[model samples]
Target: MSRAEQPSRRTVLAAVAATAVAAPAVAGGAAPAVAAPGGSSASGATGESGSRRRRPAGQVDHRAWASFRDWRSGTAQGTRAVPGRRPGIAIAAPAGTLDYTDPHTGTTAPWEYAVWTSPVHRLAVPATEVIASWNAETPAGTWIQVELRGTYSDGTDTPWYVMGRWAAGDQDIRRTSVDGQGDGRSSVWTDTFAIDDAATGLRLVACRLRLTLHRRPGTGATPVVRRLGAMGSDIPDRFTVPASVPRLARELVVPRYSQEIHKGRYPEYDNGGEAWCSPTSSQMIIEYWGGRLTEEQLAWVDPSYDDPQVCHAARYTFDHEYAGCGNWPFNAAYAATFRGLQSVVTRLGSLTDLERLIAAGIPVITSQSFLEEELTGAGYGTSGHLMTVIGFTADGDVIANDPASPGNEAVRRVYRRREWENIWLRTKRYNASGKVVSGTGGVCYLYFPAHPSLRQRLALAAVGVR
Candidate 1:
């Protein structure tokens, strides 16, 4: 599970070579603005720092630590903030070592570790749920753990819950999300930390993230964390969300690769590619940003296989505990491992946010679930699925690169805007079995160049990412 370099497959990857983050940042002019969650216009707007707000902010609030200043702002114990094109924190010296028994494999080993705790960030929108994500590179003998502690509206604090214990390679440890973590009032549902009784009006008013970087005892190797953040939202519990009027007509020529093509290819990775919608969608957008796998890096794949990169993605992004490649942050962190790219997991208010990103030449990966009849033209349905939003048709319909297709040739699908939006942004839904279930609530992954264009940064800022 150790990657010297992760490989990827391609159907129509762009020829743009990866660029350096130090290359001149194009930022003198005003940041571009996206439609404020319900329209189609690419208009004028400012970043979070600007006094003239782009528009009313959405229900989701994303706060992450990435810049050198942001890294230095955090309280570090055995860690030191490393400054570079992308500022990060690393272990200057180990705080101590502890023996950890693998819950899944039952292998006990001693690991040197260091901790970094972020400054408390009060949520602009007090949320009933919060999901944390981080981007890091863990060497063969190293890994990292992310945890969250929050203060509820009543002023009581929640215990530190382990959000994830992750490694890029599974050689040292199996990447997993800890279960059975809760405080009578709230709980961790796999990757998300949620309030148990949101109807009581209890909400997460603020939270802090704790990052622990782990390495083998007596090794100089360490995990370097480039980005860490979380999304907190209080999406209304409803089967439907207010619909948006699509105003943009544009399409990005993103690559198309299907997860169905690799069904049963690697059963060890979450029962094979049949459930690889997350990684497949990630790989498509990664290639769209000029990220590619070299032949030498792809040496691990079976020569008889087609699109070995998809196989590679599925294997690397697979979460052992979840037994699937659908871990939202794991997929985002996987995409960030590529050269000159940064990725984050956040929520958008509506498809209008998507249109703004597409207009800025960046494609988005969205998570949604639907009944077979809820969506037209999609022959199958699932409790969850991921698709790449490449563009919009002249009629404002969503132009998506759905990896659930039968083959790469049928990957580009046009889903009605209303149907796609409702399925993606709603917080509640009814299953085919006539049971109430949870929806994605606008969760998505945004990947872009480390040094984005003026327009790209503006588009991102407009969506409250800066």
Candidate 2:
């Protein structure tokens, strides 16, 4: 069915109030006891002989705040002020230009594109995914295309792979179009793109990257690229996790939304809902933190559409090169564009690490692949997909907002801990010849308020987050 003809589903209200629970002890050390807002201890522990416990004079309550606060402000021990880690590496682009002449007008215009090449980055451990992120400001006649090349240990270099061409609105370099006449006017956009064998069949060992910004000069507005960078990781060939670790929290209630219901709604934005898991997951978290697109921002969307913000997200995060919204770092960069929030793309070692983030009131968006049988109740399987890890069950099962669901009501579902772990952390698949191939490994995008509490920082630090 054509996207414009797709049926719109009713918006289901799924906001649930979050409740506080005792902070789990980390690494076998008891977390310092803190008082609840009422000056009472919130340890949830009973006194000796089963008597009701009394608050000690010095106890400070860390669990009272529903939202995270600056940890350095209070007397919380083990807390030191530290800067939040921004994900991805920065690429240095030398100056370059592309000049185009209009066939009809016989007028020539010039566009400047920054060229960035990375130093020899040796992936001693070959990774399955190579990802890039950047922010750009361009007028109607400008766009950006990114390419990559890599050198193997045997001294072979992979051909330059086109990561993507990004611009506002619909004009994409992948298509034959007039110079600089893509979608929308001057606007600032942040995007990300990824390359993997499953999609591109292009793999490399140690690598370098190239970025080009295209523009047609007659337009007065000059194109500007704020920053660009790439990242890669090696995922394990088998699915295995540590025996056990501390359970951080009982439950966290993240707002739920579904992408499947909106499938085929906007083909220009990568066929809308069917390919919008990343943006849909991002929208849920954005609203969770009180961020929303203003009406002016939604003006470009179809007036009759339901939840137009999801469409806005898809458009903002879309990549002309890869042609989808599943880029990990792009979604993170998009989420970070909002005020009072910070996001990064990184890998988590285990479910326990995920538990800590949830315990700190942060929801994580993760990438994974699975067979239909591997993840029960998913109804469908994908070679690549994105979902939000909202919370966990008492027994450590996963509670996620899987946008792949057919309806919003089915978005919030649970999966067995081990089963979910295998699909999420394990990125190896066997080919027809029974040979193992690498997959996008335990990668995730973590979004949280800019000022995390002491506990949140500790959780992030434990996972070796940069």
- Winning model by TM-score: 1
What lDDT does each candidate get?
Answer: 0.79, 0.53
Compute the lDDT of residue 126 as modeled in candidate 1. 91
Q: Residue by residue across 106-199, what tens digits does model 1's lDDT show?
A: 9999999999998887787899889898888776788999999999998999999999998877777888988768767777767778777676
Scanning candidate 1 in windows of ten residues, the lowest lDDT window is: 9-18
- Segments in model 1 whose C-alpha atoms lie over 4 Å from true places: 1-58
lDDT string, candidate 2, 1-466, tens digits: 4221222110000000000111110011111122111211112233232222223211110111111121122222211222233222111232555665534335566665444343444443354445555444434555656555665434666566655455543332321112221111111112212222222333345555555656554343333433343455444346444445547545666667889778878897777788798899998887787676677667778898878888888877765444567656556656755555556666776788788888877788888766667788877656567899888887778889888887777889888888788777765654223434434456788776655566666665555432
lDDT of 1: 0.79
| Residue 463, candidate 2: alpha-carbon lDDT | 54
Q: Number of clashing pairs, model 1?
A: 1
Cα lDDT for residue 418, candidate 2: 82
